[model samples]
Target: MRPQKIEEQEMLNGFAKLFKEKGYEGTSLAELAVVTGLKKASLYHRFPKGKEEMAKAVLLSINEWVEKHVFNTLTNPSLSPEERLKNGLQSIQKLYDDGNTPCLLQAFSVQSGIEVFHQLINDSMSDWVDAFTNIGLAFDLSQSAAKEKATQVLIAIQGSLIVSRGFNNPNIFINSLTNIEAMYTQE
Candidate 1:
């Protein structure tokens, strides 16, 4: 794969952070330009499709991040299931600590032109589900049960992020993790 130019990667990272802080409708091209240290024309030059293009880029970047960090941690061969869950929760905690930003998938889902963004979201989410399901299977769960648990974990995570941000408390995510661990233990 060809490496992205530093400027292009910088702009995409800035867009990802901003879009996480502010939903698609709330982010303006001018704000993106300011955050990226690029003129509006320059941003448009890099992303001809404008804000939508930037939003797509931001979502893709974060999806890749989640796959690498969170999902990979859960599936790491060196970590036991309990350790994997702990490491995964720690990864999430770091994300919250870094910036109490909203979930990009949920943020984009509610936007006006989100239909254009669904494919990326769906693919990323499916991959996440698969990751968790594989972990569950490794722990001796049946395939169906594993996938169901994965869905539950995903839903709990999404809800935890929304509620945690809404309540201005990061513990909601930790609490959700506890509940999920309990569920797994009961199985």
Candidate 2:
């Protein structure tokens, strides 16, 4: 019940960064403690189920972030489809730190991590597709076309992230976003 040294979001960010770098199987309690500036006891106090629980919390936090920043922007009734796409892509850029950060979803999809967090990962990805599909609908694409474009958009994003990191070029990611915009906006 006492005040903690680290704020909750800060603590989760610490955990998320480590997980994104190392994956759930690779991260350890000691490393998490060091990253978060918390003792093992404090971490346990917050996550009684231990590392798996922490990973689940990190995944949930990421889903919430995507929902708010990406999904909401794309679906906002107040914005034009163009405006929504622009803002949503901006949020995506920030989410990945302009391609400097690896995706937590990718990091957590390694064999062991997938085994434990499959449902959460699957649902997050489906939600992403649904959001993009909705945006495509706003652009007057048919439902099937919108869904196809949505799948392609997700592929572009995930593939570009890997290529950008591999080539040490953030522009790959930036260009992918541009291409995605064109996909929906261009005839």
Candidate 3:
């Protein structure tokens, strides 16, 4: 890739991490400029709509990544349930740093709020649940059972993320994945 494109992607990754750490309303243009090593005017030159545009780009990038990695890993029929679940867990774990980091969906949905990004957040989560549900179904779980298991898995993951972040413990998150994998094999 071109040097300019690489720099642009580096900026986007920086913005995404900042938003993950600080959320939309909590993040500031000055901070973004600092993070990206660009002046405020240059940031404006890159994203004409300013912080909102930058955040939207980050969110869109996140969705694309999740679709390709997490969602596709879960729903890939060519992979066994064991393989699918393992790959999905691995991808998601990396995304959140094994639960040390907050999920972009939760961070962006926090109190201050960005109404425009709400649909993106919701769709991403729904896609997760649907992917997990599909995995459950592949394991021979009843439709209702599969949906229930999917919900449980999501709850376990998000809850573990909270615990891991709060107590500075990533094992809680890792153990949650272990339990989720058990959903298929131990049955």
Candidate 4:
């Protein structure tokens, strides 16, 4: 049998998707209640601190995913830097749904949980950048140069997602990944 926390995490994952789409300010307790199949009282019981707490939980889970599945791709010892970065880019692709999805961090950046949201976003992004930097280091790039490349990769991924979403075009997003790969191979 699954533990209760597993069930809770499953519910939280559901909430994460809703919050990703609607954001902290836009998503309501009523919506959460409906989506989670719980009453307001039940939600309060599970998440005693209310909506802020729920958003924190969701963001933390996302951070954990970044730490686990995403970063691990960069750290995998068997893969070359190119392969690791390519895998990481694929993870980024899936995370943003080929640019069709909204960023959960962008969603949480507004509304009631701004402080926690921003801090978690910073922590999560720093880890992502760090992973990219590590991949560059594997290719003997200097720390500063690697950091810059990492930032560029992140910017490309995020910017592509935003633009592609705005224009309803995923090809730009795909091309952005290709460009990053070529950039890496060129370096």
TM-score, ranked from best to worst: 2, 3, 4, 1
Pick by lDDT: which candidate is best?
A: 2
Clashes of each: 0, 0, 0, 0
In order, candidate lDDTs are 0.79, 0.91, 0.85, 0.83
Report how far off residue 132 is in candidate 2 (Å). 0.4
TM-score for candidate 4: 0.90
Per-residue lDDT of 39 in model 3: 87
Clashing residue pairs in candidate 3 (N, C-alpha, C atoms within 3 angstroms)? none
> TM-score for all predictions?
0.87, 0.96, 0.92, 0.90
Write the number of the candidate with greater TM-score, choosing between 2 and 3: 2
Sort all candidates by lDDT, best to worst.
2, 3, 4, 1
Among all windows of 10 consecutive residues in model 3, the one with the lowest summed lDDT is 1-10
Q: Which portions of model 3 miss their true places by more than 4 Å?
A: 1-6
lDDT tens digits, residues 1-187, model 4? Answer: 4334337888888899899888888888999988887787888888999988998898888888877878999889998888888898888778777777777877776665467667788887888789989988887899999999999988887788778878989888989988988887885
Give the clashing pairs for model 1.
none
Minimal lDDT window, size 10, model 2: 107-116
Model 3 clash number? 0
TM-score of candidate 2 against the unseen true structure: 0.96
Model 4's alpha-carbon lDDT is 0.83
Q: What lDDT score is found at residue 56 in candidate 4?
A: 88
